[model samples]
Target: MTEVRKGRTAKRAASRAVKRRALAIAADGALILYFLFALFPVVWMVILSLKPANELFSTYFSFTPTLDSYRTVLGAGEDEGVPFVRFFVNSLVVSLGAVGLSLVIGLPAAYAAARWRFRGSENLMFTLLSFRFAPELTVIIPLFVLYQQLGLFDTYVGMIWVLQLVTLPLIVWIMRSYFADLSPELEQAALLDGYTRKQAFFRVALPLVKPGIAAVSLLAFIFAWNNFVFPLILTSSEAQTVTVGALSFLGGDRPKYNLTAAAALVSVIPPLLLALTIQRYLVRGLSFGAVKS
Candidate 1:
């Protein structure tokens, strides 16, 4: 009886081990497939950007890579037709402006929502979310009319204000959650030690959650930087963003595929660089409130 029991136990353990190994292998395969799906478009973009104009639609998959497209897009060519640098500067300005405005508005709102048990706080937060989720087109026409009437049409300030809608709710919601997860005890202790509420927040709470703040700022910056529609209809040449500028490659006569790809590559660089630089903060910020002491 003992010998039979031992044999059965060994068989069950072996079966369980095999099952675990199979599950792990399946998971790894799925991840690889997902990674490929996500990366293929980026690879294709790089290939198209590098290919010379003549080879753009060639049947052969192979082509000699050249810097002509990049040079043209970067305004390194003799003609300097494309105002890539100007568009880049405009995007940077708008992105920074949006981030500054959102943080200014969102931080206090988030702090109040987290710390105060005010009447209808939940409703207010939900209302903010509703605005956030609403389609941009729905508001665009009204905004356009209003801006035009108010003499804000085709202005940088108008575009920045419009982008605030994109960045504000995200900042408020994320910061509020982070603040809520943080213990009030820390603030209270600081207060007891003679620090004012504002001082306590700035000195104690803010410093500790610097990672979350950095993450939120980075996210806000990226959203504003990449926004296409607002800049598309809101402003013309004077305040055009990289997204709109990139579209210039597609004219009425013909599509400049190589130039478009090059423009796209140029548009992608700043945000990608920012993301890479602040990736650590992003991870830390996202993981905030995920664990408990």
Candidate 2:
């Protein structure tokens, strides 16, 4: 009887192990399918960018690949080919400027909102956040008129200012939470150590939330970079960004799909590189202060 019971127990353990293995396989297969689905468009765009104009319409994959499309998109010289490089520069300036301005202003505002109970604080935060939810189209017409009046249209400063609508609220809200999650005791200790309020923030609180800042800054930069409607209407050429400039290929008598694809791939490089460099901080930033100790 004892031997029979032992054999039965062994069989049950093996059955459970087999079931676990099947579940794990299913989960991995599902994840793989999702990744393929998500990456299909990017992969197809890369293939399109490699094809020459002559073979762009070819249904078969036997055609030779060429770099002519990229050359056309990037231009032979700074002033020779398309102005895509200029547009790329404009994007960098405006996006970086917007994110920089938001950090400078929003960091203090977030810290204040987190640590203090000023009157109308909630209302003020809500007002800032409301900008995010409001559709850009609702105000773009008036904003365009204002930009024109102020001579801000097609200017770098104007683009950065308008993009505050995109970057500011995100930094404030997310960083506010990070600040709130921090213990007041730390700052109190800083004060006891003879640090002024400003010094306490810069020396004590700021370093603690560096991860959140990196994550939020990356997000703000992406938002500013990808903004299309503001640049499309507010700027013509001088301040135009890659989002609007890339579409130029679709104009004229004939569409240049290869050039368009190449432009897109080139534009993606900066943000991709930035994300890759700071990806280590992203997970920690997002998850920090999420749970109580």
Which whole-number lDDT from 0 to 100 does residue 60 have in model 2? 50
| lDDT (CA) per prediction | 0.84, 0.90
- Report the error of model 2 at residue 194, Å: 2.6
Candidate 2 Cα outliers beyond 4 Å, as residue runs: 1-20, 77-81, 291-293
Candidate 2 lDDT tens digits, 3-70: 99999999999999999999999999999999999999998888888998888886556678899888
Best by TM-score: 2
lDDT of 2 at 253: 76
Count of clashing pairs, candidate 1: 0
Q: Give a tens-digit lDDT track for model 1, residues 61-120.
A: 589998899888876522545687788889999898988989888987888888997678
Question: Model 1 Cα displacement at 54 (Å)?
Answer: 1.2
Model 2 residue pairs with clashes: none
